[model samples]
Target: MEQPPVTPRSALHTRPKSQGCFLVGKSLKPVVAPIYKKNGIFYAEIFLNWSHIVGERYSRLCRPVRITGDKPNATLYVGASRAVAAEMFYSVPTLLERIHHYFGFQILESMRFVNDFSSPHMASTFSPKKEEAAPQNSEEADASWKGDDITYPPLREALMRFQSYMRKIK
Candidate 1:
């Protein structure tokens, strides 16, 4: 697949560059966006998924961390409780073992946990509806199906052809 050319940041905007920092319009504050390299390497700024954390006692004690990397390299950083940390001083190896098994080797390197001040907010509660509503019509149902384009006839013909081919092989 052909990719669109990436416009250099310098060409798109006028800003002073110094020590890997860039300025945005009128604000002295630096603007930073996570830029992933083509080789599936990237950084992730993550906070705990508090809803999931708070619900489970074990997970809450040893807070689970989240990390996002560029495509094919996203990872989650899991932390341990003080006691757990003390017991296993060399924690990275164990954590890496779990991560490698769960997410595969390409996505993760290591885990880092610190006494960060922030915690993510939990979602509010909502009542489950007693009776779910049915779709009004076929048009509404078809509209709800996600995709850029829909060609049912061609898809149906393809499926029929595949089934015929399978039967012949059997």
Candidate 2:
């Protein structure tokens, strides 16, 4: 009986690991592939359904700015207000654990929460609501105006003064 020739593995051309699916263009791969291949996450959905990742409480105070690198310990940049940034500091471990569990891998070893008070959304999240009891008098208003919660010193002060003036007028 004649023996069939065995194919040698060395002769077979191996595709480069970086080479993305043939169906997707090279240009689109960088934009679309990393989320899935690197983090085992849905790319567009990360931004589209961001609240699902960080939860409703943090979603308003913070937002995922970007994911850097393709390593297992990739850094996830989260934009947050200075006020809420402190809260996130203590919750980093819990958040990372939740994110890892959500992605089914430790795709992010750490999160970098940048205190970006300049973000319009950040101010809205941390700012005191206008519904708070209007000051009984200008004296009380001026005394109550503290700089502690101010995201933008000038802007917040101006707005507070304006609100106080409006209350006086009414």
Candidate whose lDDT is highest: 2
- The true-versus-predicted C-alpha distance at residue 27 of model 2, in Å, is 10
Predicted candidate 1 versus true structure: per-residue lDDT over 63-159, tens digit per residue: 5555645444445554654455555446556555654554345445545664322222121223344796668985565445443344687786776
Candidate 2: lDDT of 24?
Answer: 46
Query: Which ten-residue region of model 1 has the weakest summed lDDT?
Result: 116-125
TM-score of every prediction relative to native: 0.28, 0.48
lDDT (Cα, 0-100) at 126 in candidate 1: 31
Q: Which runs of model 1 end up more than 4 angstroms from their true locations?
A: 1-61, 68-76, 79-83, 116-170
Off by over 4 Å in 2: 1-44, 118-170
lDDT (tens digit, per residue) of candidate 2 on 1-170:
99989878866777656754566466777886755675555434556777787687767777877878765767878887776788778988977787767767666667898877655465655676668788998779778866568798898889878877777886
Candidate 2 TM-score to native? 0.48
**lDDT, each prediction:** 0.47, 0.73
